[model samples]
Target: MKITEKTNEGLKREYGIVVPNEDIATKVAVKLEEIATKVSLPGFRPGKAPKDLIKKKYEEAVSSEVAEEEINKAVDQIIKEKSLKPAYRPDINVESYKFGTDLSFELSLEVIPEIEIKPFDNITLDKFVVEISDKEIDERIEFFANRQKEYKNSDSQGPVKTGDVVLIDFVGSTGGVEFKGGKGEDYDLEIGSNSFIPGFEDQLVGAKVGDIVDVNVDFPKEYHAKDLAGKPALFKVTVKAIREAVKVEINDEFAKKFGQESLESLKKMVRESISHDYEMSSKMALKKRLLDALSNEYDFEVPSKLKEMEFGAIWKQIEDAKAKGQLDEEDKDKSDEELKAEYQDIAERRVRLGILMAEIGEANQIKVEQKDLNKAIFEEASRYRGYEQQVIEQYTKNPRLIEGLKAPIFEEKVVDFIISKVKLNESKVSKEEALKKEEEANEPAKKKAAPKKKTKAKKEEE
Candidate 1:
């Protein structure tokens, strides 16, 4: 076997490899001998086939298998000898291959870039701290109370209005023909909820009890029901009752309903929940700043193969969004070429940042513990409610999904490790202020105009 470097540019490496015919012939012969010990022929007992007959029968199969095995072995040797970390599978182009002839091939691949670990301690980041106010906790408690609020028949003898829950029997039709699932009896619908088809609830606004009215609406183009989508329908509605919501008092009884020991305990839990949310938001903002800082500090070349793969993934998501008519508002006006160019740059940045994060994790020995992974798996499974076991089984069956879960866990662990090392200046701010700052930070930076030099006359006048 012989190997020679064909090209070496940045992270890309190409090699030309040649394997002597004898090596391949020997491999084929060994494979044929192995097969002879198991295979049976028409006129021979099992394990008693003639060697030439076995070779004649399985020569092509054995030859192809041998070629693949040899190529893999050669590639492995090259990788080991060069200490190369490939970003993706190396592309093997067969240059020459025939039975009893030398096997020649070109191996091309992009190797992972060597990233230098920057000093995390040198990076300074501002950590926004939002204190969970008593007002916020009270608001959250009120939110839970609202969910438990009761509804009773309205006292007023008038038409329905927003915030009123109306009980009605209705039959919906398109083109004067009723459709399946278009009829409901005594359904409770909140006037302003927008739960039904667009314009359906609005048409019922002035309807009074015992009033028979026709509510007209058009199904959205993207409606879940394919048959009813984009169709205009008229619902013959018979309003049965009108009810107004009565707010539930946030007392010990209300707390007991939620399985809490007392109202104070419920408020404590709500405060803790709100605090946790704010803390998570703060951590996220800090992590973004850390990553942006790291990206600025390190400008190493990323493997083109990885960049291309990332770009492909981003483009695929964009295409999917476009197909569903959910394309980003900012991206809607951009041409395909413009979007591609913009997202390609984003993909490159992501790949570079990923490489940096991995390198940092490696340097710091950051790891995602099995217990943490189990917790993540359990949390993911819990999202499916009754189908938790099925979700768990699906994830367990798909190693790729498990890895997808692990990647974020591992990345977060690395980010935490970096955060521990960095100097975080805590700045206390209101939740609104913190959120406003986050929004501004995430917005794209506008290019600043160069300051105009004051003319001599203007300066003299001033």
Candidate 2:
């Protein structure tokens, strides 16, 4: 066998390999001998078939199998010689081949680039911190209490008003005919809630008790009921009673409704929840800054194939969104080439940062444990409400989705490790200021699927 370098550039390596015919013959003979022991022929006992007979019977099939093995070994040899890590499977180019001739081919591939790991001390970042204020906690509690507001019959028995609740009996019609789900009796409708069709509530603004009102409204074009969408309707509304609006007071009795022991306890829980939200915002802001800093500090060539793979995934999403008429406004009028060029940079950055984060995790031996995965699965399941157990069982039984959750978890751990190592200057900011800062810091990120990849054994994201 002979091997020679054909091309060596940046992260790409190409080589020409030639294998002697004798080697191919030897491999075919060995494979045929093994198959002969298991395969029976018309006139020969199993394991006792003559070599010439076996060659005649299985040579065509065995030769192809042997060729594949030789190609694999040749590629393995190239990787072994230089410890090459290919970004994807090497491309094999074989212009011609036959059973009794030298097997020659060109192997081309992009290698994973070598990344430099800068010292942790050299990276400096500002960590935003938000200190929760009593006012914020109070506001959160008030918002929660408002969700459970009560209403009572108005003492004045006057005309209905906006923000007031009304009891009504009504039948809705389109084109002088009543429609399905058109009638309600003693139904409580809030004037300003916008729960009913547009203009229905506003038209009931001056109705007194026992007054019958005809309300006209148009169902929204995007209304969920397709049959009624964009249609005009008239509702015969009867004002049964006027229910005045009421806001729940912050009291221990009110707190008990939510299972809290006292108003103070409820306020404490509200404060904790608000603090958690602010903390998450602060952490995200800090992480964005850290990622930006690390990306700025590193300069290395990423595997072109990997970048292309990432760009392909992003483009697929763009195409899908376009098909659904949900594409971003900025991308609405761009040519394919223009969109590709714009997103290709995003792809490259994603690949570069993905590689950098992976290298950092490897250098520090950061790992995602099974417990971490369990926690993530639990959190994911919680989002679906009542199907939590079913979701948990499904995720537990399906390793693929669980595996999908790992890259981000691992990236988060790497970020944590880097945060601990780097020089972090913590600055406390007001909740409003920190939120604005977070938005500003996060402005540049695409906030979508990144180029998450596992090298060698696993497939890169499509």
Candidate 3:
């Protein structure tokens, strides 16, 4: 057996391998001997079959299997001896192979780039801290209270208004012919909710009870129902009743409805919820800043294969969005080439950051504990509500799915480890301010021309 380096470029290696014909024949004979022990022939008992007979009957199949095994063994040995960490599976092309000839093949692969761990102490980042305020808690309480609001028939007979729930019977038609799912009886629709077609709710805003009205609306161009998309329809509606909403008073009974002992306890719970939200948001912003800083600090050659994979995934998403008419606002005006160029850079940056973060985590011996993984699994299961146990079972049954859960846990742990070593300049900011800063940070960068520097003569003239 022999191996020779065919190509050695940035993070890429290609090798030419040769396996002697005698080695392949030896493997084939061993396989045939093993098969002869289990397989019975017409005249000979299982293990007593003649070697020539077995070779004549199974040589082709056994030789092919032996060749594959020998190739894998050779590749594995090369990888071990070379200490090569491939980014993805190596591509092997069998150049030539014959029954009585040396097998030759080409193995090509992109290896993981050698990343250098940088000192984190020199990295400075702003850690925006937001304190949960009384007003925020009050607003949250009001939100929950609003959800528990009750409605009653309006005492005054008047037209329906915003926030009023109207019960009506309607039949919708396009081109004077009614279609399936175009009729509803005793449907309760809240005015101004925008739950119906774009113009449907607005047309019903001033409709009075006992009034029969023809409401006209055009289905949106991208309506989910293909037949109705971009089509105008008329709904003949009879308003039956109008109900006005009444907010639920925050009291002991209200608190009990939510499984709390008292109003104060409910407020405390609300405050804690808000505080958790703020904390999570702050940490997310800090992580983003940390990643950006790290990406800027390190400039190394990332494996092109990994970048292509990342770019392929991102491009697929863009194409899917375009197909669904859900292209992002920022991308709407850009040409396909322009969007591709922009997202290609994003993909490269992501690959670079991912490699750097993994290196840092490895260098520092950071790990996600079993308890942390269990907690993550539990949290993921909780998202399914009543099917929590089933979700947990699904994850437990599938190791691959468990790895999906482990990836984020591992990344977050790495982020937290980096955060611990870096200098975080904590500054208290209002919740709104913190959120606004995050929004601004996430906005796509726009190119601006640099102002021309003033010469000394120009400065003197000015």
- Per-model lDDT: 0.83, 0.83, 0.81
Each candidate: RMSD: 8.0, 5.3, 7.7
Q: Write the per-residue lDDT of candidate 3 for residues 45-130, one digit (tens) a residue.
A: 87899888888999988888888988899889878999998888898999988777899999999888887687899999888878
Candidate 3: list runs displaced more than 4 Å.
Answer: 169-188, 212-238, 443-462
Pick by lDDT: 1 or 3, better one:
1
Give lDDT tens digits, candidate 2, residues 272-383: 8777877776677677677777777887899998998888887777777777677767678989898778778778877888889988888789999999999999999999
Off by over 4 Å in 1: 174-180, 323-325, 444-462
lDDT of 1: 0.83
lDDT of 1 by residue, 316-417 (tens): 777777787767676789899997887677777778878888888887888888788788989999988999999888978998888888888988888888
**Model 1: ten consecutive residues of lowest lDDT:** 453-462
Which residue pairs clash in candidate 2? none
Model 1: how far is 274 from its true place, Å?
A: 0.5
Model 2 misses residue 411 by how many Å? 0.8
